[model samples]
Target: MEAEIRFGDFVREVSLRQTHISFNELAAYPKLDNKIVPINRQNEKLKVSLKDIYRILGPYTTVRFVDQVKAVIPLAIYLMFFQIFILRQGIADAALICGGLLSVMVGLMLFMEGLKLGLMPFGETIGNTLPVKSPLVVVLGISFLLGVGVTFAEPAIGALKAAGQIVSVEKAPYLYAMLNEYSGALVLMVGAGVGLAAILGTLRFVYDWSLKPLIYLSLIPVLLLTGYVGIFDPELAKIIGVAWDCGAVTTGPVTVPLVLSLGIGVASVVGRGDSSLSGFG
Candidate 1:
């Protein structure tokens, strides 16, 4: 007999090699008897100690925390030096800045860990399972929705919106309106574009289409639109930079892993291995 035990993200299989042994005989085995008795009693107690919890989670938390520190520390140091030395001005409120930076570091650590341990797995699982279990339309629908959801959820989108807050309305009323008043609609438009891109990208994976042609086709429309906006709507033309920035920011930390995981999972399942771009799709 074999038993599979799952502990958080870890799994272990235990096999009873001496299946024929009776309860009395099992008790006679010194190492097995010693370990199994305590484990069985512990299970019966049904009590979890903080130490045990820490043992299970400590390494994962420590590694993720360290990774975030390594990522954020350099930026923090650079900013501190630039503010104190180059600018010759101390931080406005040292305590507040420290608290805020600590909070950000912790939040980023948790978020990154969650992405690695949860979201990426979920995305890959859905991508791998959908094509096999659901209809093609359903898979495409899910992909489109995922794309839209990830784009809207991205942190970089908020930064783009923030950039709009300082834009002088008098200088570019239309741009300001789109960024502030019609921001929801603007986000929807960008999300829709991303969703469509995801749909086409998935289709390309399924049918083994060349990415080169798609790139050319997309560029033509983008160039023509840029020219049209530049020529016709000068007020709205001010937003051309922001509009292009939206595309870049759409593929942020949250979106890229989720979308890439989904794309790679689907491609691995349905695609021909011969294609040079099988997983790249």
Candidate 2:
């Protein structure tokens, strides 16, 4: 026989059998106290003592450190082998290089940890919260500003600028001039491009726009400009490497996740159903 059961607003159908009956048969029945106990246990776990916290965290910390070492060690070994064995060259500032390598490893470890613990959560929170609290214009505006800000602050920009020091003034005077005299303007230009990209990316999510058309439209102007520079501006052609690098580097670790989060947040609120292109920005 089948029996219908109703409790509060919920209803379910159950079969009653004559063959056997057991406590396990009623296991699916809802228990008010059972539900509350798990929640309370979760709350208790959150309120861990320092000793308990260390015990829980100790293995994870060691694993993270080991993973970082694995990433960095191979390159270090290769460089050492090439310098000492293959090239037969004496290492200069052995102590300094060693120190620098150690520092880089430590910095990378800290940076990874910071991204996981800090930047990702912060970006996700801002992204998820901003759309609900603000208008569309406000959301786009914030995304644009964030793009510009992060692009300007990107470490790769500084590296590109430093690379300008090696350019021979006689061969590429304009390139040298742009990198050295007008570097601030160059960074601003790249920042503007990134900001525009961020705005468009956000809009794509809002409208469920296909990435294909956007990609084609963007590439047309870029290809035209590249061809024009290649044909007419020989000097500018030389610094095209730096220009491309600037564009490439603008979408670094800091900018990508933050912008993606913001895009996802806005998309979740405005769009009706999840699209294949959601959170792509």
Top lDDT hit: 1
Pairs of residues clashing in candidate 1: none
Q: Write the per-residue lDDT of candidate 2 for residues 166-185, one digit (tens) a residue.
A: 87899889888988999999
Please give, for residues 106-138, the per-residue lDDT of candidate 1 as tens digits.
999888878977997788778778999988899
Itemize residue pairs with steric clashes in candidate 2. none
Q: What is the C-alpha RMSD of each candidate to the true structure, in Å?
A: 8.3, 13.2
After superposing candidate 2 on the true structure, give the runs of residues whose Cα lies further than 4 Å from its correct spot. Answer: 1-58, 81-90, 271-277
What local lDDT does model 2 show for residue 160? 86
Reference-based lDDT, each prediction: 0.78, 0.73
At residue 185, candidate 1 shows an lDDT of 89
**Sliding window of 10 residues with minimal summed lDDT for model 1:** 11-20
Instruction: Show where candidate 1 strays beyond 4 Å.
Output: 1-56, 84-88, 231-233, 274-281
Q: How many pairs of residues collide in model 1?
A: 0
